[model samples]
Target: MKTEKFQTILVSASILGLAIMFGCAAFQDAIVPCYISPDALDYADANATTFLPWTTLFDARRIDRFMDFRHLWIQAEDNLQYNFLKGLNAFHIRGSEELKTILFSPTGPIGLAFPALAGGALGTYLFSKPKDKRKIAELEKENKK
Candidate 1:
């Protein structure tokens, strides 16, 4: 009887947790501001290196602090990437050579697709799995001690 009661509580908590987690669309919860300065053109030229390496894009101290581990950072990074590419394309369409170099360079759109696809897949996998009773029972046992 005790075990059954524990199971009921466990299942209820799990449902609540999942509901809170999966209720909002992952990237839709907050706005991430993305900007490209026209003044950046002073430092960026057709021959200038606009793309920074991934490591340099994030701060070393922040990396040590594990800033990337948070969902907010992940979502913000995705928004930044999407906005950057979208801005570049918009600029190029309006005949901006500097943006054209950045947008249509040798690298192309391959890099852009990776993160968007990976994040979508991860969110899908996390939300689609049903709660497992085995894991719940194990957790309940741990809490009893």
Candidate 2:
């Protein structure tokens, strides 16, 4: 009975954890990254304008420059790319930092442990051999005496 309850908890935790991970990733990827706000409207004048590629990754956080380099790609399918490959360089720099952290940190494997345990628990629970019914029956009879 205790084993059954533990299996139930493990299965429930695996499902919930995976669901949250995927949901958050989806939300992050689907962001449009550019939009006008009510505050911007209030500040707007007859001469107000937004040049191309000015809308940044987070528009709500700050106002974009009046006329700046193309913010399009960061690869815009049909727009001017960043001058001198600066955007690509920035991307590689950030990726290098991430790789360094994962490679150097002992705790990197800590992130991997969750899915390992969750999957192991669920798989064992599902594929494990059943206990002998005869043994359980005999034990119960002995207890009754």
Candidate 2 residue 118 C-alpha distance from true site, Å: 99
How accurate locally is residue 98 in candidate 1, as Cα lDDT from 0 to 100?
62
TM-score of 1: 0.21
Q: Model 1 — which ten-residue stretch has the worst lDDT? A: 41-50
Model 2 — TM-score against the truth? Answer: 0.24
Candidate 2 per-residue C-alpha lDDT over 27-129 given as tens digits, one digit per residue, 9 for 90 to 100: 5523545555555534532122333353433443334332122234224634345444777889899999998888656567655776778899999877644
lDDT of candidate 2 vs native? 0.60
Clashing pairs in 1: none
Candidate lDDT scores, in order, read 0.58, 0.60
List the candidate 2 regions with Cα displacement exceeding 4 Å: 30-145
